[model samples]
Target: MNEQNDNAGLFGSGDEAPSNHSNNPHFNDLVAGITRRQILASSAALGSLAFLGATLPSLAEAGEQTVASQPLKRRNRLPFTAIPTSRADTISVPPGYKATPFIPWGTPITGRYPAFADDASNSAQDQAEQTGMHHDGMHFFPIDAQRGLGRQSDHGLLVLNHEYIDAPLLHPNGPTVVNGKRVNAEEVRKEINAHGVSVVEIRRNVRGEWDVVPSPRNRRITAATPMQIRGPARGHKLLQTRYSPDGKATRGTQNNCSNGYTPWGTYLTCEENWAGYFASADADMPRELSRYGLRSSSRFGWNTLPGDEFERFDATRKGASATADYRNEPNHFGWIVEIDPFNPESVPIKRTALGRFAHEGLIFAPAKAGRPLVCYSGDDSQNEYLYKYVSRDRYWPGFSHGRLLDEGTLYVARFNADGSGEWLALDITNPRFLKACLTARVTFADQGEVLINTRLAADVVGATKMDRPEWGAVHPDTGEVYFTLTNNTARTLADAANPRIANAYGHIIRWREQSRDHTGTRFNWDLFLLAGPQTDSRGPDGTALTADNTLASPDGLWFDPDGRLWIQTDMSGSQLSNGPFGNNHMLVADPRSGELKRFLVGPLGAEITGITATPDFRTLFVNIQHPGEGSTATNLLSSWPDGPGKRPRSSTVIITREDGRHIL
Candidate 1:
């Protein structure tokens, strides 16, 4: 969750059409040969479509049929050509673009922290007051009326998540461990403080550059911050802890990855891969613990340190009951935490009905006045399932703060081999689910257990095992949901959907609900893009990806207001040096034309993660995470933002067109 599993660095952080051609006759023939069972089995995978049943069309035909079926609207194309891949230690952008560094790592926000030191010597308190590290999915809340009266480009609140810490870069001596035990409490505290969300006031300067303006809005929600637990799991026994005996609250939100901003003006920062941060000492651990990938030892052994502050990382039962110690500590994380950025003092709420797992991000479906609100999320672990939450209550203008996420039904996706899928409700009352739980030997005591152990429930219900589903995005126009299945090396057998044996280079999969209904259970899905070399065979259509659009380890996906999909890459280790994919970069895709182009590239040892833009589409923001991830303190691989001799600092890049034109 925090780490990219095999790919290092701090952790953080879709679809197309069909075609017609003489060479594509095989695909067309496959489409004609599609049987009812075949259509149901592989309805989600991309291929030629023409099933006798009323299943979703193929990717090639989807765009055509969709355009033909709906009111015609002009699709926007990327204004610039694809930027070539590079090994430069700088950010590459389109020809007419200007990139400015804004709010780099350790930028002080609350004025309590001093100027950021280059030697990684900032104190724990300083870190708590400063901006967090490894900026990921973020959003810009314009400084207009509270509930979004108008867009404010010149001034706004920039809310972002600081994912995992770069231990070597954050500590003076790269984390102290003496005799197989962590000794430095302050270092661990600094790391904890660096793993949450940061809110700061940003304004455009006279020169059209964005500057961090210190204000009361500046605050950091770190690992030690207390947060209220909301939804069905609020007072559950599994959530009770010594810190919050009533089970109403708990400390911290770590591994905050991609985020979601609500129409009601709140920031939803998701907790991903948080299980790796804890160490469970007991062999007979809670069944939910191992299911979430919690283990006996962690990369940062906070449990080995002294004091209750550090001991909370030991999730094993230390006392007789859950409230006696930190047995329920891990349960507090792996949730979508909602924070009111406009009101700095507002307490963050862990929305537990979102179904806890390694949540990559949450992308809300387009809001409708009288329709139930829907939020889509993906579990980032290898072979994990995709999930979505549908609120029981309908959306209205200026609804209550936590009403949407509080009372909702959480569902896990089950993609049939034929490209069709159904959202399996996690509710135990469903008869089919009861039999599934019985088969898995999992007895659901209540709804809380079903939510706390959501992945287990998903497995019991036979959800599809994907290739490490990561970031997700909802098309503003098409109402299609896209998720990046960012590589899975552990996979051995090649399935009909995920066809690769050892899927090092990942792919993007997308789905569209019937009648564009986000709350609907049944839908059609298909592979949008396969991330790999140009020479790689195009599986079904065999012409979807090419040299100009090929990419590996697709992550950090977003759709700008104009419907341009932005893709960020995460390739590390030999993938960088051995192939044309050198360093991480960002790409832009046009859904209607099925055209993708490389828009920007980052410096050495960096993964381009977070991405956001103003409502007017003038100002764009992207994050450069862990610019020198694999390098040692003495010998660095990249020294970006500050230039060559300086230590590499992760920073956010602010971009705008020099010609003052719209981004598309």
Candidate 2:
């Protein structure tokens, strides 16, 4: 989720500005109807309320309440001393903590465990058996289920998403091209093989050091792996590509960014910026393609080569029918893919009932035994909408499965000026939504078509255009949902939900469901914090941020077992310009007191992301992605984990306390 201006061409590049949400009602219009004094008064009144109370217990709390015949007690304060920000080309942690790099890119996990070559000489076949590149949202699934879910601290399967690739660092040289076309097929294949998810079995040895263990459970699901399409949009006419004429299946998952997990023990990897991988030469593209930012060219020139596998990247109508050419290839992407880490033989399923866009990630609300299963997600592009999905059937304790995700109602949010919001259903059966579509002259044949063009449907319903909504987290005790709106440079109007214009520095917003009901259509929200430098930023209490907590672009967010909010920053383009914030870092905040402290900082040219921990909360894992991002094969910007003269590869860092105490 790098929302920098330099990568604008690869993301939301088109004739229409990304901020332009068609002719529908703008967020500014909602704010203009209220007085400024009234808006400020409402914010000040809500600032004193405690986010967590004796409300409904969240699913996170329900699962962890009883660890070993004892109730899990929540910690009231942060234990570790806060570390200062840094610019050094290495990981920085507190004085009593140790950080070790583990299983970097090209580390073989399966088959004949091929070691990584520093010169990037590994073949595509070797890449299939190794860890993927640019590790992002991750989780640790304990193999010792005897201790129950999220209770084991010794062994587990480490599942993480490989968001994307840096071709210059991936190949012997950069991408090879002759006359503006890719000349090497192996290079393209290896790049494709590096774009999915990795499942590795890891354990702690006798020395208490965490290391990767070679096991049959180790596997890689790349862009060429077979996957099944499931949900309302599955087998639709729009999904009828040359590969899957019936549209019941697709080949792979790419651009997987953030992630989620189910109570049934399945992994959910989201597809972000997936539209950039496809190119359509047609001048007049369908609303489904145009609304999601598909263009005349792709991010990587995988479509420039010969062969059906390579030609699939070129989504043009040439054979006079949707099934003849790859015109509908783009429809196969932009989904929430589910994988069972425990079962290596199972096929990944793309759950389409959860409306598709640039899904940053998905977070489930607390699952009640007889209540409907509910989850929330966000579109990562500028001015996109936030969404919620509620299953049609009630949840059952041990009988829940992926089928629960197939039949559901998807809704987009609309924030009003008074801080109260409503969830507008995206279903065509809803009279209000259908009327809005008819008024806008947008027609949909069925719910499948409405979901396929989800962005356009959101636009027609007058949903609030948010500042790039990224990861979301639900409080274990309170069930309050928090989402990070990564900075949006294109925004010029102010709204109650997003109050800043030209919002270079983003903010965190949270909401509580009405009457403690997750299935309710209403919520009450407030701004948690405005992220920027000390002089301009505001904390939870509306005071200026201190030097110890100044930051920007809050990307990855998670709440530890004890209810500590861990925040990771992605200040990509602003790292050099923003002098006060030295580099990308991680912070810990007590939501009860609004006290925040800088905990860890990553190397230069890297974004700190993907965080998880052992069940005991003693061993924590964090990822450093794309170190020395702009470096080429010859000139290196950073050589992290390894010293100088070595390539800076994206690797996961394991953090542990010297005294062997809990992380909180």
Candidate 3:
């Protein structure tokens, strides 16, 4: 979902400080225990056992197995053949699998909403009453069986994020641009309503087929929905505006990309790439705002609609102070929003302790009693930093999630060249960080300021800049963290870590914390997969990719309970049309051997994203976004998931095994 840009901007320019040797004896001791040698030896022995015809436990029984406190027991190899790359305008799953197109854009969730019109003429109010567009990251929260029984995966709430809008195809004739400005106010409103999260009640019928149930639980949290601002930045001066003078609340959450689910039953939709939607007219704008690429003109020109409500997109100083106008609207976004899927009346809360950046997603580490909850997030921008947040309070059997996220310490990663890394604290109380902020021309007035300008704080502390870090996933069995570095076209210089110059096809990196501790500040990392075209050079680790395994611009990542790593592609430009990477596909990889197998290929001009499986692992859901995005009305590349001649709509595809067996 990243748009390429030159690295000359404030957020992308500087090189991070070289990694320093660790002086902490405790950190050094933790790294020595599970050295590379020990892990490699364990992997080699496990591979030999598998080769000798050893049968591992079934994936369905993995939950009953007692996971080791240290490295987890290896699972069996993935049992599906690799689906070939194709340019077809339909989803192609494995031989024994079936995919059903369920709940596309504009599907009505309430009685007041009208059915989807084929002419693409749904009004703004119609969009608010119907399902939102562009389904991205999603989670299926299983409804508990009656009388306190376990999860009922057959029925639950399906909450998915509508990342952004396909404006041309959404409106009737197209977006109305008159004299370089948007003049159609109704068109802009429809676009706005289409850019948030949607919660729908879904149920599995007697035939085991799933569809929308259309119950009262169905709800849409659009761009106009009211939301409360919480955590460290709740009442910060930078977040104050005419909309909320106390800075404790705001209007809505938009541009939600990837997502996370809490143990206590809540959905966490992350805001990403929100900077391009704002405008600031003043010449002397805030340095932090400029750093994030907020300019005088937005990509959509929503502020040109000639009203104070529409002008809220203008984030510059006006009328003398912040409260006099909507000068701080941009600051209120770029956060992880928590929504209670079970309670339709509950208001969404913006958890500000997670820091403000283009948050790709948050993947929680395995929670343990007496230990602070830990989660990993990535800033999905070029040359951005990886972040980890440690809750201030230790987790108990029934701890409150809001309290856990409200107070925590956010840390930015500093990867050393010697295979080690340190988590630099973003807390202003640290004297070393305080001195670094002064040198970077940023003043840490308070902890709220530290979080508002998160990129600046990371820069001052010398955090390692990464290639566009996207979706992250935590191993269901092991505590290892894996994230996709989706691609960085602006990188001209090479290093041992980011070895490719102009790296179009990216890589995945995995790391383990000290002593399997989620809240520990030290870690050991290594490149998991270095992806590229077939003719491209092999990775430094001597891993070669062939046509069957070639993939470009890996974006969405997830780990099913069966310990399978699901990788989704987002190939762009000439690469999509020229290489082995045909229309974006989903691939499954073994974390131990890096053995990859293509699982499915999506429709033409669509990116395969939003991977989630039912608790039973029998039904899997995948989203097809922006189909026919590169085509014109007269020359459509695809009208798939519907039929020919019908306008292509972004929708969710439910996949399962035809024989009632578990999907591999």
Candidate 4:
């Protein structure tokens, strides 16, 4: 989900820092009187005006080590600091509170047409009228019909997750290709309908309100949107692309990245760096080129250039068969999608019984009438494997009550270094590993090639390989799940769920579940935080540590509605891309006091992607993206969430705690 880089924004240093930690003045006078009772009432009058302006903080609502034992510091804390470069476009919180843009980057949407013009000419209906650009992992579903309620909120259903696009500020003078091919099939169908998922519906206005309700039931699910792949790598033949010649509808849903929702509400999303946007030629099929992991998909020159939407991402076959040319458009793209963000007519279903790699997040587990509802996923690649599906039916919480997300039963994941792990079942009852609908080798016409070769049948059943895993949350109070192994520069040579070798910085595994507390068959784990930098560097037994508990590449991860967790950096290794681990920051962990801070640091060439909160844990969004990518969008490097001459636009900001507390 990062490469073409540069959305610009770093207006050569100016300076200005000292506000936001509730931007003080009495924590912005208590989130300005409880968000002005959320724009003047109507979530049961803002839960009776937050139980008449909810007082009773007992240490700001005990969570995250009670907001990390209250001493926050940082008016210039670590030897680390930066954001002053005239604070371009502005958004530097931590002092007392204040962050706005709950969503930006061609904003407005309600079905279609409004965003276009950073020089214009983008259509696929300006990607359902815009709101997709590196957003990443979100969740706010609190229309609270009250069930364990107390943290009152006004309106909800945010979803959000774009995860890709910058192609020279998204068109008008960039992304054309014209000769090596790809002269913009309508700017690659407006950058694959500005990559997937949107949902918006937030509320609470009238001075005590939430935001984003652009209306007409605002919705969008791009990358062409039109799913239904469901399990066992649907029609395998590696997801046969070229516009579903036989892959069963799959127009789009690129890099998606983190997101989850179920309990019967449905939303899932996920799809990390989706096999580097295709380039493949690694000598015409080196085993479908090392079975669908494409070591070079992001050369971003868009397959020779000029169109048929970037020459169907070169899957070879060069013509004569597979129903002539366009070699099945990169097997439709890494799976997991799901949507139905509250059924806006619904249709986003890639579930393929959930098994595609590069995915990154999918949580869900607490469902147990008769058992088998489990979910947990992660395969963000690099050493892959750590999936789970289990759902041969049992959860009837509303039993798909408004269109249940198609039956379930997908599995693949093994992890066991005595640490213990096992789920397996990519099923067909495993006739020699994922084979099933064998109408003579046409294999699995149903569970979609078992979630599309679910990482080649978890490498034909063995499973385990990790490191790069990215997001996964849960523990709405001990249902425990936590994930983020995010950095593993290919550890050990032994294969199978990472046997252990030069792993680099990464570690944060978690577990717990023996019988339906979000059951993934059986659970119980450990080894929580271990990113890197305490010393040794990479070893004399090197575990390294400290950047306030050092963190190398731990990509976008969340866990808010008060269970804490946050994290965010992509670090880029080589000592944070160019010395002294500068940009990319968001940290805040505390999984029961293993502590670790940082709280916010993103600017000069950003990377701290997505975070989400707002279920009354009062605001907290996140998502910086592209800041100063490949440089020069007019000499930018990061004006941050808003700064500089205005070019960097991978928006989403929110953040709160200077006194409205509760931000461990």
Candidate 5:
């Protein structure tokens, strides 16, 4: 998903396109390959991307990123260009800051065990005992400063999400396959443990140091961890699996993408692009079949492995109906999970109040003491829909919220062709839903059912479909929410959300709430960014359509502490080696002026993701995920931070302004 934009983070996969993969093709609609006579004149003008390997590497290697390794003009200095963009192997930060590999795959998060044993064959239980990777979106909770812990104390909690797995290099001999099949149940158990979230307590010393503080509160949630399923789907026949016969609960959270934190103190981890892993065989799992958009087994063929653990993707209960067969297991996943990070003793819960899709991230509006709480999300797929949820109860300050989260209405966004939009509530209370379900004989006993089956309900209401929506961040100064609309491969002009014929570059669209009311139905919106070549695909459209303004596939997005919006890229296709842009890089934008420029570019074969700023606005943390991602550990395509000879590793970089100045 990082390679494209549908799923913004490096962990997940995207949903299927409606008709085609992408809406726009590079040139004019004309497909002319004429004879020698016709070849005399030019047919179409084409644009180029600056992502080619040979040219990019040669240019980057010639320059140096060792700017941080030497002395500086300022005493408490910051490295201006300490890290250069390269296809090398390592993460980079400012000269004054250091990036330690705090956590990696299979590392223990509880701080109870020694470092992970190299080549260790850990089990599902052991996995539940360790920290998971690739660590995607994270937030630092100040336990001492704000949570009433202690004033002026530099210590707090770290809440993070483990998005998904990096399968190839996970095992010693590559997942122990027996005759083209997965090796053992033990391997499957190890993988299950790697898929959830981690919450740990960290503290800083008077010397300004940061380290983990081992406490009983430190905990982990793995594949087999016990989670409470709270939604309409709970106890539904479709969710009944061999593991949970009653279907009231399930195992773990998979493909967790971007995350959000409620003002009331709960973690929202989204499940995105989850359907790709399942294999719904026609004859074996008719209950799991969905001819409209249902897919076959995963491309990785993990189900073919030689054990039952590898067979969960089969999606059949071996019984008669949905209840009999446990065929609806896939439904249990693909929903947003809410975890009480501070309450380590309590189990994490999945809030079905939010409609399901390829959930990229969940961002909430600033809570007013008596106002209805609201949140927004994007379905990370080509030509998907933007969504919002309104809490049924006003947010209660302090630590008073317990069951109110379960009672809410979910809605999908509909952007009008005239630039206005509406949030259609998908609740049983609506006349349309009540009448439709009654006529169709689909019984809905309570609000829980409505929240659980949110997608179907939204479809009945009709919401405006949008380009692939990714990670989103709200502008603290303006209260406007900005979300990344990664390119829709099947982008077409027939839809209002996508007006242009060839939406090659994609865009970042934002909207401001009317009077800052989260429950208000109407709001004003605008096109904050238009991505592509900033030139043209060669048509009647103005060259203004595709020029320096044009940049393909906007992905990771976040608002820095100072309110500056940082935009990152995920260029795939012909753009990489043959494109015009130098390489995938992170850019900074003045949201007030729309004046944007490249702040830092990344090396080849890497996606810049998960950016956050320190509370004081003096420091920034950015993730360099999956460097040389396409390369095997043996082949070694990219050298990256250290260059070719060293091993490629994923790490976080701390960016600070040079001269110790405030970053604008």
Candidate 6:
């Protein structure tokens, strides 16, 4: 999640300005009109209770009432006790809850099912068959019709995103390098094979423990997998690479972070920090490449090796046209890739209509029959923009396909000081956008080019430049959208929306769509929580964040069916400085009462991300990523899951109640 510095891309130079919002005169006037005190007072007055009451549709109007809106027959308070902060290298949960490690990195799931080696000597082919590294966003699809059971929780397919890898921990003695270039071809191949998605069959055994079940459905989609490019920018000239002269295809999805699922049961894996993986020495790089932070060298020196497959990482213009070389390769990476987990033979499609720019993740609003589909995504860089897409065609139950994502109008948000916000259409035909582009002297060949340069388009239109926006969640009952602004130390201007200067401790902001319409262009927003030390932080009620609920750098966010907001943190850079916050952890918050409680804490140097649950909500799955992240081959900082003397591995943890009841 761009855990490096506020200005830098995950592994690239921070060449772009921290924020242009302060420079826009109109934006300045919007913020200058409202005082911070007024903003906070208005937000507190519209507390959680008021928020729920005002935004929720009537039961009859909404058709069916979710479990969250039912009367007092259900438990009203949070069931578990809040745990204290800890620094110990272990998983900590509240009393009556059990957390078990499962599907760790390098565990075999497909092909011959090779066993994990403690010394990390597995081959590149072995890695392609095994579970990938750094598990992020995931979903559990129940095995219902196959087992003749409706919404079965015991058996399911676990689909998760394997984000970027920890190179030092991947090999036995670490990567081999001669000079500044990577020399070991096998190491490079294995690293590329580890970055993508994994689909595995898992089931609960009679002994009440979850285990990977050998099945034909098990598969791994790595960075080298062939994928089709779809949507408005599908066959654009800018995307024409040597491998795909027609610009309709590309090789691989990299840096997959948080994910989403479609109503038709497809998985959406987002490619984040992908621009840093490409290098170009071209003097006159286009906006499509330069705007996304392309550097002179790549994070992993895969481009240093000889061969078209490895050399594609070097995007320099060495050919007469875009199709003659890999100059257009970077355009293929930063997209929301749609994967059909049920169909192993299906090719993943990169839905380019979503307007990619280091997409952190995508979250869909609840689909309704005969209504246009709506989804939201955020750019995960300092001073980047937030985006939403509305489909041109109406959605039909059991009939909708990925085509809905292909034909859509993308919009960028502009939050104002008066708590009102507008979604400015990023369409090339929009008069305001066209004027802005002309004024900035930015020319686009077509809608495809506009989508290719989404960040630049948003810049000309003057979208609100947010902090490092990471993950987003949609409340099942109220339809309120919540996004985590994972800390931005680069922020220097204080506005009503982003109310802090040098915001090291991130905050959560939420908004309800206008008139409860998911496709509405106007909305109202408020700060849900300002995370930091007890003295500086504030909750929804304007009270100080206590030791029990304080946190920093909120990253992953999700909403259970019961309306509980699950919050995860990635305090990698500040964990030592913010000692009181302890190790990375996950917490649950009651949106109705603005009450928060710490639920789970991971081992030292790990990030708590990628959360999901079974259909019955009886079992919960959470990922502990990059434990002991900065450790070297000889100087180990942590030995988690396997204890002392063993290398640390990223793994998923299963949480369940002691009494076998539903986990709340």
Q: Number of the top candidate by lDDT?
A: 6
Q: Pairs clashing in candidate 3?
A: none
Scanning candidate 3 in windows of ten residues, the lowest lDDT window is: 45-54
Candidate 3, 359-412: lDDT as tens digits: 989999987878888898998876777999999988775545677888999999
Residue-wise lDDT of candidate 2 within 1-664, one digit each (tens)? 7734454433222122363447655555655655433332222222233332223333334543575645455455677777887888989998899999998998899989998999889999999999999999998888864122556788999999999888888898877878767779999999999989999999899999887888988999999899999999989999998889999989889999899988777899999888888889999998888888888888787888889889989998889788898989898888999999888899999999998788999999999889899999999877788999999998887788899999989999997766678899999899999899888898999999988988988888889877788999998877889999888877777755455678777988888888464998988776677798887677655566787788888889999987778999888766544578878999987665567888998998898999988889899999889888777789999998677998889999999898888876
Better of 1 and 5 by lDDT: 1
> Which is the better candidate, 1 or 5, if ranked by TM-score?
1
Q: What is the lDDT of residue 389 in candidate 5?
A: 80
Per-model C-alpha lDDT, please? 0.77, 0.83, 0.78, 0.56, 0.59, 0.83
For 433-540, candidate 6 gives per-residue lDDT tens digits of 899889888788889998998888888888887777789999998888999988888667776545667878889888888855589888877678889889878776
Instruction: Sort the predicted structures by lDDT, highest score first.
Output: 6, 2, 3, 1, 5, 4
C-alpha positional error of residue 134 in candidate 6 after TM-score superposition, expressed in Å: 0.8
State the lDDT at 622 in candidate 1: 92
Give candidate 6 regions above 4 Å deviation.
Answer: 5-32, 42-74, 145-150, 495-499
Q: What's the CA error at residue 377 for candidate 2, in Å?
A: 0.3
TM-score against native, each model: 0.90, 0.93, 0.89, 0.32, 0.79, 0.93
C-alpha lDDT of candidate 3 relative to the true structure? 0.78
Give one digit per residue, the lDDT tens place, for model 1 in 1-664.
2234353212212010011111211111223333423432332224242232345455445553454475344444676878888888899987888898888888999957578888888899998888888888888888883684447778998899988877777876577778867887888889899889999889988987788887998889999998899998999999888888888988899888888988788889999878877878889887678777676776577788889888888887878898999888898889999999888788999998998888899998998888888989998876677998899898887764577798988898876545567899998778888998887787989988899988778877877666678999998877888899888776565544455678788887788886555898988776667678777523223354565666789999999886678999988777766677777889888665556788889998888999888878899989988887755567778888887666788888999999876777
Q: Against the true structure, candidate 2 has what lDDT?
A: 0.83
| Clash count, one per candidate | 18, 1, 0, 94, 42, 0
193-310, model 5: which lDDT tens digit per residue? 6777777676655755556677776788765567777755667655667667777777678777778877756667888766665656665433223421345545345566544455
Model 4 is weakest, by summed lDDT over 10 consecutive residues, at: 11-20
